[model samples]
Target: MRCFVTGAAGFIGSNLVDRLLAAGHEVVGYDNFSTGQRSFLEGAGRSAGFTLVEGDLLNPDVLRPAVAGCDIVFHLAANADVRFGTHHPFKDIEQNLIATFNVLEAMRAHGIKKIAFSSTGSVYGEAAVIPTPEDAPFPIQTSLYGNSKVAAEGLISSYCEGFGFQGFIFRFVSILGERYTHGHVFDFYNKLRNDPSSLEVLGNGKQRKSYLYVQDCIDAILIAVERADAKINIFNLGQNEYCEVNQSIGWICDRLGVSPKLSYTGGERGWIGDNPLIFLDCSRIRALGWTPKLSIRDGVVNTLEYLMANPWVLDARG
Candidate 1:
């Protein structure tokens, strides 16, 4: 199969590109290097089956033609800056919501009937349910990032219903593994590297969150795309277990062999749209015989190890 993946140079996208190539599929990777790293694509560049296109999704003239003659579209590009969504109000809509519209329109123009989107668990927004299910009712959106994803999910489902398209929507918890550039793990590691004696944590450090390794995330995506045949298939991709923010800190500190003085700004949530707890019920995907190989602790340690080995990622991100 010929696969077209957006955000192809990103952490998860680059990893997925390598996997698809290994599975004997031809892949065309589309990316704008705004937050994507070229170094991440070194492995993909070696593959004869992989083609890289440099363009932004907001430009349909570029995106539409680039998407031509593709079997499936994996729309993974988006503004995932949830913590700073309020600072730049229009960033989420233009980068996420409008960009998704463009991708859908491009797919429609090119006769592409199948799409897999990277949605987020943030869309749940402080749910009343603990382990939120795929069918759980969405509460008020707490962040602009989540709001945009919610809108994008609706658009994808509508396209499936109105245009005979097959859509796979995976709402993921925080992903951790190699090529992890952003998120709490990256932030904490970067700060600690600079100042090993002190570490300032956000909130009260009790935020319980579930995470999935990058490979495990891609596994669920491929499985769902292959087996699930609904017009709009929605699955929550996450570990069944979760860990507290403080517990994860212990793991990171233990691995780094540094005990920094911990100080916290007294609050229940980290940021404006931060949910205090995020534990998704992934039984739907688990029923497909897919399970994450790494626990939250393992994932965190692996991510830190990657950062330590490749300090350039920290310098580049900074």
Candidate 2:
């Protein structure tokens, strides 16, 4: 099988690329290096089945060829910086929604039948249902990033129904593993390293959310793409449980041996688009014989350990 993966140099994208190549599939990786690291693809680059392309998703010319002749496309390219969505209002629209438009158009043109997109739990936007299912009614989106994902998901579904494409939309919680670059774990680790005396938290130390390990995340994607048969399949890929922000901070602090005074700035959420609480009901994907093996505590601890061992990622993220 031939796979074209956007954002293939990113944390999850790179891991997915490695997984695909190891499974004897030819992989064409597309990335712009805006946030994705080149070193992340070191192993993928060495694989004979892997081909790396340097390009941005916003440009159709760059995207069209990458999509050509690929059996499947894993669309993971997007502006993942949800915390600062307001800083550049159109970044998410351009990078996520518009980029998805380009992928769909290209896939349609080339007759590519399958696409697996990386959606987010944020699209649920303070969902009314605790442990929100994939079919849960979506409320008003809280963040621009989440809204962009919602738009992308709709486009994929429309394309699937209208153009006969198979779509796998996986709404992910926070993912942790090696090459984990951003999010709460990264923030907490960087803070203690900079100042061990105090750790400044974003929310009121009560923001709780579900998480999945990157490997398990990839497993859910593969499982859905392989086992599930549907014109449009949407799965909430996450752990069976969730952890609070304060709890995660405690775990990170314990691993780092730092007793930093915690300081939280916001009330219910940390930022404009922040969702105070999120826990996805992942039974939809689990029904297809997929369950997360990593616990939230182990994921957090290993994330800290990876960042600790690879201190270069912090500087590289700059």
Candidate 3:
């Protein structure tokens, strides 16, 4: 199969590219290098079956050409700066929502019917249900990034129903692993690197959330895309278990061997629109013979190892 992955140079996208290549699929990567790093694609660039399209999806000229002649589209590119959603309000709409609309339109024009969209658990908006399922009702949206993803998912569902497209919507928790440039793990690592004596944590450090290893995330995506045949397939991709922010901080500190003095930023939530807790019920995907293999602590430890090995990522990403 010919696969086109947007945000192809990103952490998860790059990992997925390698998996697809190993599976003997021809892959085309589309990335603008805004948040994604070129270093992530260093290995994929060497594959004869991999082609890189350097352009932004906001531009139809570039988006249309990049998605052309693709069998399946893995739409993962988006502005993931959820914490600073209010600082730049319209970025989420343009980069995430509008880009998705453009992709759907391009797919419609080119007769591509299958798309695997990278949505998020943030869309649940402080969901009342713990271990939230795919069919869980949505509460109020907590952040602009979550709001945009909700709109994107709706658009994809509409496209599937109206245009005979097959949609695979994956609501993922935070992902951690190699090439992880952003998120709490990266933030903590950078902080400890500068001041090993003490670490300041966001929120009360009690915000519990689930996380998945990048490989497990891609595994669920592949299983759903290849096996699930529903017109609109929605799956929650995450570990069955969850953990508190402070708990994860402890594991990270242990690995770094820094017992930093812990200071609270004084809030139940980390930032505006940040859900203090997110425990996804991944049974929907687990039924499809998929299960996360990494614990929260293991994922954190692995991510720390990656950051330690690549000390330059912090400066390069920031």
Candidate 4:
């Protein structure tokens, strides 16, 4: 198979690139390196089957040609700054929503019939339902990042219906594993390293969240692409259970062998678009015989270990 993956130098995209190459598939990687790290693609660069293209999705002239002759499109690139969406209101619209439209157009022009998108569980906002299902009704959107993803999902579905394309949209919980650059784990680790004596936490630190390991996430995506053939196939990729923010903090602190004084920002949400709880009912993906191996605690610990080993990522992100 020939696969074209956007955000190929990013956390999940780089992992997926290596996985595809290991499975004997040819991959064309696309990224502009805004938040992506070239160091993450070190392994993929050694593969004869992997080709990296430095380009932006907003530029169709470059993106269209780069996507030519691809069997499938994995659209994983986006502005993931969910915490600061209000800072730059148009960042999500330009980078996520508009960029997704460009990818679809490029696919359409090249007659590419299949696409897999990285949607987020954030789209559910503060849902009334616990362990939110794929079919759960969406509440009013709280963040620009989630709003853009919801709109992108709609665009992909429409393309599938009108152009006979197959779309696989995976709504993921907070993903963790090797090569993790951003997110709560990274933030906490960075803070602890600087000041081992104390750590300032956002909100009340009781926000319940579910997380899936990166490899597990890639496995679920590949399985769905191979077995599920629907016009628009949507799946929630996450662990069945969740952990509190405070629980994750404990794991990180334990691993680092440091007990930091904790201070709270005093709110349920860490940011404007932050959801206090996000536990996805992944029965849809589980029905396809896929289950994540790592628990939320394991995921958090592993992420911290990776960051500890590769302290360069901290500098790169900064």
TM-score of each: 0.99, 0.99, 0.99, 0.99
Tell me the tens digit of each residue's lDDT in model 4 across 1-90: 999999999999999999999999999999999999998899899999999999999889899999999999999999988888999989
lDDT of 2 by residue, 1-318 (tens): 999999998999999999999999999999999889999999988888999999988888878977899999999988999999999989999999999999999999899989999999999998999989988988987899999999999999999989999999999998999999998888888878889999888879898888889999999999899999988999998888888999998898888888888877969899998988889998999999997889999999998899999999988884
The candidate 1 region of ten consecutive residues with least summed lDDT is 287-296
Clashing pairs in 4: none
Scored by lDDT, model 4 comes in at 0.94
lDDT of 3 by residue, 38-74 (tens): 9888888889999999999989998897888999999
Query: What is the alpha-carbon lDDT of model 2 when measured against the actual structure?
Result: 0.91
Write the residue-wise lDDT of candidate 1 on 76-184 in tens digits.
Answer: 9999889999999999999999999999999999899999999999999999988999888999888899999999999999999999999999999999999999988
Number of backbone-clashing residue pairs for each candidate, in the order shown: 0, 0, 3, 0
What global local distance difference test value does model 1 have?
0.94
- lDDT of all the models against the reference? 0.94, 0.91, 0.92, 0.94
TM-score of 1: 0.99
Candidate 2 structure, TM-score to reference: 0.99
Provide the lDDT at 304 for model 4. Answer: 95
Model 1 segments beyond 4 Å from truth? none
